[model samples]
Target: MIRSPRGVEDILPSQVSQYQWIEKEASSLFSLYGYEEVRTPIFERAELFLRSLGEETDAGKQMYIFQDKKGRRLALRPEATAPVVRAYLQHNLYGKTREWRVYYLGSMFRYERPQAGRYREFRQIGIEAIGEGSPYLDVEIIEMAHQFFKRVGLDKVELQLNSIGCRKCRPFYEEKLKEYLKKNMDRLCPTCQRRYQYNVLRVLDCKNENCQLVIREAPWIGEYLCEDCSSHFQSVKEGLKALGIKFQINPHLVRGLDYYTRTIFEIISPVLGAQNAICSGGRYDDLIEELGGPSVPAMGFAMGVERVLLALREEKKGIPYKRLPLIYIATLGREGWRAGYELANLLRLKEIRVQLNTSKRKLSSQLSFAAKRGIRWVMILGEEEVKKRRVILRDMNSGTQKELEWEKLEENIEEIKS
Candidate 1:
């Protein structure tokens, strides 16, 4: 038996319903917030990730890079934000609107050690609001994310918020941080040391015990935020408060992506323990410009689908899989089979889920198959029933059945099920 690649999952039929339920809830909810769905290619130029996520970032290093037939380097998108921004510029959407509100649900590829609720091929449901610099938009995005978890029945998800300054003032904070790190070099982890050299902001988010201690006392960017960023951060807090969306101000909340500037946040649930950030995103005011586009301010976040599901399970929440009532047609000989096939089509037109029997098995075997599949309703069309212009609707649950006139089959199925 051939096995799937490491760190990937098949999303078997048993689990698909949970995913569908989540996606449906997301699509329905996001649409109400003026976020249209957008889908981009699964892969893009490898340089896109390098430029957007930074070469030192975790997403950057874990990208699934490959060369195309034309020898152009490409990578399966490690995240969707970069690709969404790319499409926003490629299609010149900026010319059409002051801001673009869009949501996406898709797979993101990354190479990492497979852990619980994390995978190399994981699904993300996220939304991006590009254009404008109003802090109200930030509040809306954050509230919308909070609403998503609430609607998904997730409880106790706390939002950790921070401002990482911007181009103007971040340099000054970096200098102070560097000076602080220089004295604690021996206490830093290897990864933090390297991150300090390439991207000093990343060290604040280091998971290492020592790096976190060093970061806990390091110079926070909040104090160095420029006047404009300071005001914007204040407004975001006020707006969130106005909506009763509670959040905590964390000074060491630097995101993994380098482009993120001002107002970064991660939503954590106690149920998930240490690696508990089910969703994280923030304002990348300069990302569009960095990607060779105009200075468009954008706010977005991605939620790990697998992680959310895992959290749901950890909380002992039931999966809301909507199992529609199904009617299984068990036919006997050629005559019954033909009548059953025709009746199945007619029943389906009325929006009934009909499972027409295709095998040449005995009635007992056919009924046994339906029971094993947990089909509660079975429509029996034997030779006698076909000749009598009627059929038997069996209730698998109670082992009780009733005969219905073939002419009134559709009406009877609807009436009996109800």
Candidate 2:
């Protein structure tokens, strides 16, 4: 038998309830925040990601790129934000509302090495708040993320926050950082050494121990924030404080995306070890304009579905599965099978959860099958019942049986089961 690809796994029947719970809870919570759902194509023009995420970032390097028959360069989306912005622009959504609050849940593709919670094809739950740049919006989005974890019963996550500054102040900080990195050039890792020239701030985000040691002494962007950025960062902190949300200021917490500006954050879960980030996002005030849309300041975040599941599993949190069918109709002979099919449809039409067994088997065998499948109630129909215009209903849990006329079955279902 052919196997699934290396980095992707099928979501089998047994594990589907967990995913369903997450999606349902997310939709309900996002709706409370006035965020409507938006879905974009799985594959978009490769240039969408290239222009939004910088060419030098890991996202750019790891994108699943290909050319279509039309010779158009395309890619499976590496992230959701860029495609959302593209959709927002193409449809002229900005003209309808000053701020567009939208959320998304979908699969994203990347060509990275497969790990415990990381995959070549991964699912993400994300939101985008466009046309607003208020410091309060930043805090609100952060609180929204925090509340989601809380609602999902994840308690071991930490929120790491930072301000990478804006265009006005970041250039000065970059210059100072470059000067310091130059002195420690010999001690820097190969990746950081390369990042030092192109995007020096990314060097602060390096995970290598030696590079982190060197980065510890480097100047922080917070120290060089211009007046406006300084005030914005302070107000964001005040907003978080007002709402009683706890966060830590991490000077080295520059997010991996190029479009990020001012505020950045990551919610880390210790359960996953090194790849512990369950969710991360920040302000990207200029991305809409950069992608050929009207100038719109936006802030959003994306949470990894796999990572969140891992955290929930480590915590031993249970996700309630959807209710099972209360009734299973078992047939004995050809006439009984025909009656079972008709009755199954009738019950379903009345909004009852009914499963009809298509296999023509002995009455004893059908009851055994229903009991093994955990079905609470089983309706046994045979040629004798059809002539009598009645059916035998058995309570699988109690082993109690009852006779009911066909006309009374719908009205008495709940009472009989009880």
lDDT of each: 0.91, 0.90
The candidate scoring highest on lDDT is 1
Give the per-residue lDDT of model 2 (tens digit) for 93-133: 89888689999999999999998999999899999999898
lDDT tens digits by residue: candidate 1, 55-89? 87888999999998999999999999999999999
Model 1 stretches astray by more than 4 angstroms: 322-325, 408-418
Cα lDDT for residue 322, candidate 2 = 50
The model with the greatest TM-score is 1
Cα-based TM-score, every candidate: 0.96, 0.92
- RMSD in Å for all candidates: 1.6, 2.3
Query: Looking at model 1, how many pairs of residues clash?
Result: 0
